[model samples]
Target: MNMLNVSSNAFMIAFFLYCGAFIVHAIAVMGRKFSNREPEAHVKKWGRFGLILTLIGLGSQLVYFFTRWAGSGHIPVSNMYEFMTFLSMMVIVAFAILYMIYKTSLLGLFALPITIILMAYAAVFPQEVQPLVPSLKSIWLNIHVTLAALGESFFAVGFAAGLMYLLRTVKFDSSAKVDKRQQKWLEFTLVVIIIVIGFIGTVFAFRASGYEAVFVQQQVTDVDTGGTNDSKIEKVIYHMPPLVAPHNSDTESYTSFLGMKEPLFEAPSWMNGVNAGRKLNTVLWSVISGLLLYGVLRLIIRKPLSRALSPYLADIDPDDLDEISYRAIAIGFPIFTLGALIFAMIWAEIAWGRFWGWDPKEVWALITWLYYSAYLHLRLSKGWQGRNSAWLAVLGFLIVMFTLVGVNLIIAGLHSYAGTE
Candidate 1:
């Protein structure tokens, strides 16, 4: 069979393995619910099984990526499908690390489904092999793309942990009889919401402000050897090749179809000079709007912010959540800095002929890196811990998500190969 077919088949096998693991985890959880005691052995067995399956799935995914790289003669993250695969793999690796550290079987239950969803999403996008254009043929391709994926994956795990922290802190009245079934259900619901909101926010933000193109227009005037300008002049428009669609097609049409019908649309006037300003604006608005909505909903539910916080106040030692958040960030921050910033710059220099061109992807990656670095610095220097750290962790993940998925989807730049068609 061809490489593509091989990759597809491997992915299918991995998908099944993940699905089986998911079911086993569910069964383990159910066993715990029925017994009103931890199904320690069963949970442990299932967790190990799930981890093994995930490892196998991870191997299969690597094979798929390698085959695709061989087939295309470049990195696999040149489109949406590849990025999803990359994202899934990164998350799985991150989950494995966390599992090793915390020894929490519950994380497997949460993380496996997310990995499956991402892999499934990848399946829906196109998987055809296309030749790498002139721009993508750089050694930096691997470093920049891989590091960015790794950083995002770390953030994804942090988000999952944050959700878990939130769920573990839920209050259901120990004074009044709490229904075991209902409590479990509520816990599950809360975990799902935290994960979903974190994921969605990051995804949306990344989509809005991640990849961008900057145009530099040069006015070329014919000059004599003496350096006196002649009347003849030409306007030469130069810019980095767009990483994705509208810009790619537009550039092609502008250069190739000069006098013919303009087949591509100009960027909206509001978006003309600002590069990725519109997308950045969209992300800002989204964050603000989401926070506002959450506030309003909280207000409606409890009639007062103080009362709404009372349950959390009573059940959660914000200090513990803050410590967990700090620890996760401390662990993830260096990995992110190394992968997203240092390695990416090295790759950029090799691939794009510049180590730091402020390409949208580069810019966003730096922003993410700086945000986390700041988080670490704040925690260490300013004694910013607990609730403050947790909030920053949440925000840091948001920034990381934007750098990973958002830049590829929303912004336009050299990373176009990482987008959906």
Candidate 2:
């Protein structure tokens, strides 16, 4: 069989393995009857085993992705199927990173199963190879998409950790109850993971693929002063024209217009005469600013601020979880900015001859970016720490998730790459 078929099969097997691992992890969480002492050595062994299995499953997934990339001859992110696969792999990688810091295998017990569901959803989409269009052939495509995926993956981890933080903070009856809460945390983590994954997966798999190219042609008569009616032909352009391959006969026209004809809708007033490249650079700088903000936070944490501050600030060190979540967002916010805003704008400029058109997807992306920016600002300026900041982290992720998936499926717009129809 060819590489895509082989990769698809491998992904299917990995999906099942993830499901089985999720189940075993759940059982381990449920079987814990007491938390009076550290979990029994055997229970720890089981947890370790589950984590190892999850890692193996994730490794297999990576192989499948690389093989598919080799077969497809482009980054596996042009369409919904490939993008969903990328998102799933990203979630696993993010979870692994968090596990390294906290050494909490419990998170993966939940995260892996959620990853499985996403891969399963991805399976339903068409995995057929589609050549990369001229517009997608850019170095920016690699930098913009890969970084965005990495940043979003970290946000995914923050979301899981935030949920766990919420669960951990809530008051429980006994240590056993806390153990039960941990199990609940596992379940909640899985749900959040799936929700984020499913949102992206469903849009690409079902909605983006289903988008239809619509065209309308009209004939009108132009009024003439000399009592003559001049017949005029007008083409009501609504959707982007079909992309032509570089080596194809139509390559001249395709390259001349930069791979697309015109906007489906009239350019919005706000976007009139704006420089697309400048807008892209602005968004890139915003992402860099976010990263710098995270660095400042890290530096602050490294110093002994407790000596200069009040007793309360000293007592509650907002250094550990808060810093981690902040750094994750700082790094991710820019990537999200690049993918959902910058590259998207570049695509819009090429396809529609304008950028920042306030399409539903575009609007939601701005909203997502602003929401996280607020989270960082509030956390830093207002001293929003621990649970409060973590909750905001969770909300920020939800907004990003909506921008990634919900906007494409629930709202109609020019960005239809996520649909399967």
Clash count for each candidate, listed in order shown: 14, 11
Whole-model lDDT per candidate: 0.60, 0.59
Write candidate 2's Cα lDDT for 181-266 as tens digits: 64454345444543444434433442444522332222234487777675433322111122211110111221112344533232
TM value for model 1: 0.63
What tens digits encode model 1's per-residue C-alpha lDDT throughout 1-421? 3877787777788778778877776555444545555557766767677677778878887888787677666778767788788888887888777778776555565567767867765654567766666666777566666766776776666655555454445344443444344345444444334444443454444345542333332223447687876342222232212222222112322322224333223343344323343243344444554566555666678543323433433333444445545665667677777777787777666666778897898888777777887877888999876445555765666676566556775777777663343
**Residue 155 in candidate 2, Cα distance off native in Å:** 1.3
Candidate 2 Cα deviation (angstroms), residue 242: 30
lDDT (Cα, 0-100) at 38 in candidate 2: 56
Candidate of highest TM-score:
1
Task: Provide the TM-score for each candidate, comma-separated.
Answer: 0.63, 0.60
